[model samples]
Target: MNTIRNLFPEDIEELRHLLQTVYRAIYLYQHDRSARLEASMRAAIQSCMPFLERFKPHIPAYKQRYIELLKQPDRMAPYDLIICFDRAIYELHTRLKSGEIANRLPWSKELRDLLNERQEPAPESTEGDDAADTERVDFLTSGVGASRGEAAGVARVILDSVALAKVQPGDILVTPMTDPSFLEVADRIAGLITDRGGLVCHAAILAREFRLPCIVGCRNATQVIPDGEPIMMDTTAGIVTRIAK
Candidate 1:
């Protein structure tokens, strides 16, 4: 498994090469069809300038890199590159499914069977026995106050993307950490708690953006807090209290 995992970087490099080749081919094909169409594509790409300018403040690193790439004479439009990448990923998937690529991995039969099994849906949450004991505090944890203010909501422990759907509007999002993917439910979450992260981490940045009460770097938060439990977070004090019920 370690050997197979180590090969992932090489696979990604191959994908990158595939993306570039596909992008170049499409660009040439467009140019051959009509120079006017090619010019129009460039113009369309330029039209995204205002949007990117506004978006730069929120995600400066990505926007800046994209801008730099656009400045290069040979660069294609951002959407075209995205499309090429999707195509490359699809091709890789096809090869893997056809046993033309992944079959070369020295994977054990157990591992192969596990990978082939259909993913089961997350289990339904049951109300805890203390659901009615709202006056009692079940647990307390602290961390860095990445965002300010106080919020009280039901804690929804999310370990991965598959568990994200369990989060509802105004819930306190509890996880080990966060990434850009968490933005999908950003608007719906009332507070954030992470087991790992510093002030400048992705969870912290997202909390600041939504002005949600956030406590990060609580090493045992996800383990201590039970799912569906009511919790109170005070970002100013960097404390989280699990309320009974």
Candidate 2:
């Protein structure tokens, strides 16, 4: 697909606006989907309440946590709540289908085993590892390459949209993540680096739309890379390297 890079300067500005509108629409669609899913989940949960009540004496703490979250959504993050609901539902379905709960087995142990099966092993620690210390002068961080190309610019660590004013025309944007709000400065950034996000994430989508070199899911780009330092993002190689002074 043709990107903003192929367009004239005036066309680039207009395209940016159009892309921002498209992103806004995508965000709205996601919001609506979440709302519909939440409603459907609530109804399903309500239908299963009688069955849950039967196992009230054997209900696990995680299941109870989901119940509590349903009662107090304000106390937990939206993503956390969604994950809790998902796990709870999965467990309920598994137990119902397998008839393990009907066998009068240890409920807590069964639930614990099920949860453990889905748990990912923790990543190996890289602490005190200086094997690459010599390369640190040039090698900063690396992540999944979301966009194609290379760019070198002064890194601007913008934690929020409020700090976007500090971004110059050719500055590279480093952040924990990007949302639709980041589109306001999309036309000005030379590249994008994000601590979180995958190939199809908001930052990646925006980078492709603008034909900007982008690295995402760096996990610690905001902390390891200092603001105002020159950095080179080679998206094709999936690396962001520091440009030594």
Candidate 3:
């Protein structure tokens, strides 16, 4: 870390390149793998504080370098980059400030096809052709039941945190996973379904407290369940059913 921080003075371009490389991994890992990588990175950044204390006076110089690079929209802001840096120090200069370290995963293209394709109303079937809009299985998929209960409500895919404000009472909150920030809107939703998590994750703890039905580790809930579609969360059986309207 000290060596990397030292590179900040070698040349502005080199520092920017290092920042990009670190953050790009965060961007792709969040999509392709999980948020745990981000969580770990943040933790490591926090660990660097003692070492960073000696460079306190030079922090502004480092930040100004980043600001100049960020002026080019192609270069992601350090905050949006999700690479580990001091949140408080960086927030002062970066436009992309965030308190939440881990972010929810969004629907993947492959999983979207699996859920939407089957539910799509088939074209009108002609003579000797397979019937269109044939009935499909009610339950879309299953996951680990984090909380025990059942809930039936419309699925609301929260691909971005901006949508948290729009969540309504009795709606099913579906996402890649939940972190501390998600609790802000947890009460409004009837249940929770996530693409990833385990028994110890925040979703499980919240479900138990809210007494809401919850299924984590679904792996594809976000892609499989379309926003505003009625879905049944059977936490007892760990199944999320997509109901035809």
Q: Which of 1 and 2 is ahead in lDDT? A: 2
Candidate 3 has a TM-score of 0.47
Each model's lDDT: 0.60, 0.63, 0.57
TM match of model 2 to true structure? 0.47
Residue 17 displacement (Å), model 2:
30
lDDT of 1 by residue, 88-119 (tens): 23333333455644566443333344222222
lDDT at residue 203 of model 3 (Cα atoms): 64
Total residue pair clashes for candidate 3: 0
Evaluate residue 2 in candidate 1 and report its C-alpha lDDT on the 0 to 100 scale. Answer: 42
For 45-115, candidate 3 gives per-residue lDDT tens digits of 33434433433443456554433333342344323433223232243322222223211112223322221
Over the full model, what C-alpha lDDT does candidate 2 score relative to the true structure? 0.63
Against the true structure, candidate 1 reaches a TM-score of 0.47
Candidate numbers sorted by TM-score from highest down: 1, 2, 3
What is the per-residue lDDT of model 2 for residues 1-245, given as tens digits with 9 covering 90 to 100? 23223435664344334323333333333335476554443443344344344444455566565555555544544345444444454445455355655445334443334322322123335567445633666888888777778999999999988989899999999999885567778999999999986664557655765678889889999998999999888886678888878
Candidate 2 worst ten-residue window by lDDT: 114-123
Angstrom error of the Cα, residue 82, model 1: value is 21
Q: Pick the candidate with the highest lDDT.
A: 2
Candidate 3 wrong stretches, greater than 4 Å: 1-136
